[model samples]
Target chain A: MNTIRLAVDGVNKIYAGQATRVVAVEDASAAFAEGSVTAIMGPSGSGKTTLLSILGLILKPSNGRVTLMGRDVTDLDEARLPELRRQHIGFIFQSFNLFSALSALENVLVALQLKKVARPEAEAAARSALSRVGLEQRMRFYPRDLSGGEKQRVSIARALATNAPIILADEPTANLDSHTGLAIIDLLAELAREQGRTVVVVTHDTRMQEHVDHTLRMEDGRVYEN
Target chain B: MTYPVPMARRNLFHERVRLAITLVGIAFSVVLILVQMGVYLGMMNNTSSIIDHTEADLWVTARNNSNFDFSLPFPEHRENTAKGVEDVLWVKKFILVWSLMKLDGGGSENVEIVGFDPETGIGGPWEMVAGDPRDVKYPKGVIVDESSFAKLGVAKVGDDREIYGSRVRVVGICRGAKRITTAPILFTSYKTAQELNPWMAGKTVFLLVKTAPGADVAEVQQRLRAVMNLEDVYTQADFAWATKKYWTLSTGIGLGFGFTILMAIFVGAVIVSQTIYSATIEHLREFGTLKALGAENRTVYGIILQQALLSGLMGYAIGLAINLVISDLYRRTGQLVVQPWQLFAADLVVTLATCVAASLISVRRAMQVDPMEVFRA
Candidate 1:
């Protein structure tokens, strides 16, 4: 009976071209409950990433209503969307998009800073998040100096430091090997079950099905529950 | 919150080679601007060197006199008229006429004869390296500055030279007296000047007047202007400025310098804009990531602008230091290159403005980045 934290009803995204129109996401409808992990799996060009983008408030859905905490946010002002995203949702990208100029701890601190958090408090939170990811000894190491697994952990710590209620990860472990990818999946699951935070992941790895609470499949720009 | 990441600083220094190239470009622009401006100022100062060094409070000259260097001679009675003014302390007849100096090798060069009353030393050389200003009172005696040694072909004191078919001895050598036309200046007495140039027998080019202590110089200038109705009357400062303006505006020198300065700024802006734009393109993914993390456009622009400003400040410092060393070298060679504090302030403003304008291109490119690009494999 966990309350639904994020839900989209009949959401559609269309990219209009001069010569033709492409439907990136069509009639996608789903609800992600609180303190549960949901996985959306699809092949290449299956619209999973497009759906994640819409849910992350990055792209506007052409026709649908997006509800966050029972409040309809489909028609919010464009300027207010960034603040809404910063305050409520955190995103983890597939390729581990950490700033190359910053160190591991600074990468996490930047997310908190974007949310207008104070310096000492943000530092403490960033350190705690890095420690939770078992990277306490490598806080000062840059991305180029760290391995692929370590870089992904830093990115996760960046998402965690913001203290948002919902986390959306897009292919978070696609670059890691089999062993490291499984470890990342387990880490996302633990974050959801233990901390009671909603976690939505768009990934193609079949191994993700065994750990998530619910699974959905996407094909040809359409979504279906599995 | 003090920007705990120092993202701008880190990004600017991330690539050492690119940073070095950018700094060099900025520094070159700054140096070019300062050097051109300094030289222009120095040349303007030289145009009024005689008027500036003299202790005159007012000058009475012919109505058609264009500048101090090119003046038409008025009657000597104007000296008496200036003396009749109430606040006038004393008046001395002055002569400035171009003549030819017959070199020992039979190659004659242009020279300017500055004739003043040797007894009062009013319009004579102010800085002397050898002998005395009063030495010009001797028959056919002339004092020349050390700066004109090579041009006039006279090395030291007592060297002989001919002026307009008249024999004259160089009795004294002065320093720091310069002419805008690169002609050697010869300081002599009124009698010697008239003897050297027979056409200047009963005419004087200027009447140098000094005001009494505690007297208003403006009042004396007004009274002299009223008394000498047919001639032009100018205070010392106004006359000096007139000479400087004649050289700066009447001649095309100012326009030439201005064009050079503008070109330097344009070149500098291009260098900075290309460098910053390339850097932004290289970090396109990082910029997209920041946008996805909900950073506002202002935050991203602030980082880029900060990088530009840092580059400007560092480059200005290095360029100013180099200019100082070059200015000292020029001074040693007896060339004036003026760098006042106001010039430094203006240079700083120009540098920062150039840097900011250059950053706008990068900012535009950064703002168009799509946050969703970070999700691409």
Candidate 2:
């Protein structure tokens, strides 16, 4: 009820392969509000990933309109989209995707620098984000030097550093053990329930639905209620 | 890193196979530049050594000829004009002629006959390899450079050698002096040189003028040139350099070898670019994640550039050391010597440019990576 953090209206995405066209997402539409958690749940090929991508602004829709922060953006040019994405949203991937060479703390600072934070201040901010992830001591360690849980925690720190109103997570737990994955879900849920942030998670696992406020099931590029 | 280093650094310590291949490429390329450049420096040094050994403070040649080798003879008595100059200490007649020396072994080699007046400063050879430089005289005698001994296929000090119509004794083999033309040098007495090449008449190729220490050589040369007909005079250093420049300019040495060095730099730069581009491709996902996490496109690109520069610098170090070794080895036999400053400037330029250039394509690809790709599975 606070405000729509993200809204998609009849967004269609097509993948043009050499021999045939595969509709990755068909007329997908959903709205995410601030201070809430939404989940797109489905098995493989359900178009959940595609829907998440369209929301993340990483993938362009073939048809229909998508809006973010109340601006209709489905047809926005690619060149201008990255700046908007960088400024307004944060993305969390299934693999953590942390740079192995950089320390957990350095990974966050790099993000701050990209945001054009002044150098000395960026370092302090990066440390603050790492400490928020309960990783003050672990910040000095590299991704290769960290456990899977630790790496994921560092990734969350990077996302949190973005200070975006919304975070879009794609398959955020497909790689983790149950307890570690649950910890991540609890973290995201806590951010929404207590920190006044919007969270949208895409996953095939029904086990994660309880952590989200609303659940939408997708199958063959179509969305339905469970 | 605040700025991303070059992407190619992944292979810096990560991929042994790739590093080995790159190191090999770098080492061999360096050797190519080194050897080709050695030959170039060798030619310059050869001219310097001969001119240095002559000890002539000034060279008075025929008026329009820049090179003594192309000189038309002036009067042998041009010695009088040089003596009249304020700083001139002594003046000696010197003549040069082309001839063939019949080796003790049944073969013949081309030789340049240089006539020096033994009584004055112009005729003595350097520390003799087998005998003395001045043991021979004008009527019929010669001093051979040591390398010329083997090159001429000749041996035995005091062996008789043939000049134009006269036979001369090979009294000594001078130790160090060599020539640009790669033929042997045979120093004979001034009178004998004129005797062998009768066309030389009373004219000498150059009148070797020595100045009293602290004498103004430039002033003496200026005065001598004005006093003599059909002659130009140069300080010893200028004359020697001019002799070298004669060969360098006339033979296209600078352009030909300059191209080879330039190509080496191009190859180094090309390798850097290709390697960094490939490395960037390998790190695409990593970069995407970085960008997604709030890394600017420029920071991502910067990392790759630093990597390219580091690689280029390493390659240059390896190459320069290799060339140094080659230069050191050859200098003993007086082949070619490479100077440190020359290699330093070249290597610095090569690797710096290589590092910067190699990062270009990789940086572009890095900046182009879509952060959203990380969400695509």
Candidate 3:
């Protein structure tokens, strides 16, 4: 009976182009609960990433309401969305998206600093987050110098450093080896069960189902519970 | 946080070669602008050097006198007319003409002949390196600047040359007596000048007037104008500025130099814009990630603007350092290249402004990046 941390009610996303119209997500409805890991499994071009983008507040849905912690936020101003995302949502990208110029420690520090955390405290928090991801020894290594698994660990540390309530990961293990991918999935499950943070992952790998608490399937821009 | 990560600095420094090339481009533009502006100012200063260094309170010349180098002769009696004015302590006749000097080797070089009374030392050479200003009183004696030795084909004091086909001995050597036209300057007595150029006899080009102590120079100029109704009257400062204006505006030098400065700015702006834009394009995915991570537009703008400012500051520093070295070298070679503090300040402002303006293009591109792009594999 956990509270619904994030939910989208009949949300629709349409990308209108000069030559054609794309219904990226059509009448999508789903609820993600706190203290649980949910995986949205879908094929290519199935609008899973689009739905995740809407949930992360990175994209605006054309119609329908979005609820976060029981408050409807669908009609919020665009200007207010960034602050809201910064305060509540943490994003993990498929490519790890680490600033190549910064070291792993600095990558985590940037996330905390963006939330206006004090520098002294932000540094400690970044170090602690990196340690939590078991990357304490590789904190000073840049993205170009690290392996794929280490880069993904640094990305997870950056997301964890923000301490956001909801974590939205788009293909978090898409670029990692099978063993490393399972380890990352296990880490996300540990973050949900142990830390009580609602974690939603959009992935095409069926192997993630064994590690997640709930699973949903997406195809042709529609979502179905499994 | 008040101080975010040094992302801008790190980003610029990431590609060492590109950064070096960018800085070189910016520094080159800065140096070009500074040198051109310095040369223009130096030439303008030279145009008015004679009027600026003289001790005369007022200058009376023929009506509609264009500049110090070019003037019509008035009757020598105007000196007496100027002397009669109230508050006028004394007045001396000044002669200035252009003639060819017969070089000792074979060819002739253009020379500006300046004649003033040696007794009063009015309108005479102010900085004498060798011999004396009064030495010009000797018959056919002339004072030449050491800087003009190569052009005039004379080595030192006592060297002989011919002015207007008349033999003249260099009795003195002066320093820093340059003209805007780059012609060698020769100073002589009124008698010797008239002896060499018979056309200037009984006619003077200017009258240098000294006023009594504590007298209003402007009032004295007005009185002299009333007494010599047809001649132009100017205070020393006014005359200097008029000479500068005539050379700067009446001639096309100002327009040419202005065009050069503008072109330098244009080239600098383009270089800066391209560097920043390319850097932005290279890190487009990182910027998209920042946006997806909830960075505001202002933060992105701040980072890019910081990079531009850092580039500007470093480039300007290097350029100024090089300019100072070059200015010193030019000074040693007896070429005046004036770089005042005001010029440095203005150049810095222009550099920063160009850098900031250049960053707008990058900022616009960064703003258009969709945050969702980071999610695509």
- Per-candidate interface DockQ score: 0.73, 0.28, 0.75
Tens-place lDDT per residue, model 1, B46-68, is: 88878888888888889967689
**Lowest-sum lDDT 10-residue window in model 1 chain A:** A78-87
Error of 1 at A26 (Å): 2.3
lDDT of each: 0.89, 0.75, 0.89
Better of 1 and 3 by DockQ: 3
Error of 3 at B189 (Å): 2.1
Residues A1-226 of candidate 3 have per-residue lDDT tens digits of: 9999899999999999999999989999999999989999989999999999999988889999999888899999888888888888888889999999999998998888789899888988899999999999998899999999899999999989999889999899999999999999999999999999899999987889999999999998899999
CAPRI verdict on model 3? medium
Q: If both were scored by lDDT, which would come out higher, candidate 2 or candidate 3?
A: 3
Q: 1 or 2, which is superior by TM-score?
A: 1
Q: Per-residue alpha-carbon lDDT of model 3 for B1-377, expressed as tens digits?
A: 22468899989988887778778878888898899999999998899888888889888889999689998898998787788899999888899988889887889999889998999778889999899889999889999977687797655787888877788998999877899888999899988887888989899999998999999988998888888998999998888889888998999998999999999889989999999999998888888888777888898899999999999999999988888888788778777898788998999999999999999999999989877779877
The deviation in Å at residue B121 for candidate 3 is: 1.8
Q: Whose TM-score is greatest here? A: 3
Per-residue accuracy of model 1 over A59-156 as CA lDDT, tens digit each: 88999989887789999987888788898888888889999988999999999988989888998999999999989999999999999999999999
Kindly list the per-residue Cα lDDT of model 2 for residues B64-88, writing each as its tens digit: 7766455677777767877888878
Q: Residue B48 of model 1: what lDDT?
A: 85
Native-to-model Cα distance after best TM-score fit, residue A109 in candidate 2, in Å: 2.7
Which residue pairs collide, candidate 1? none
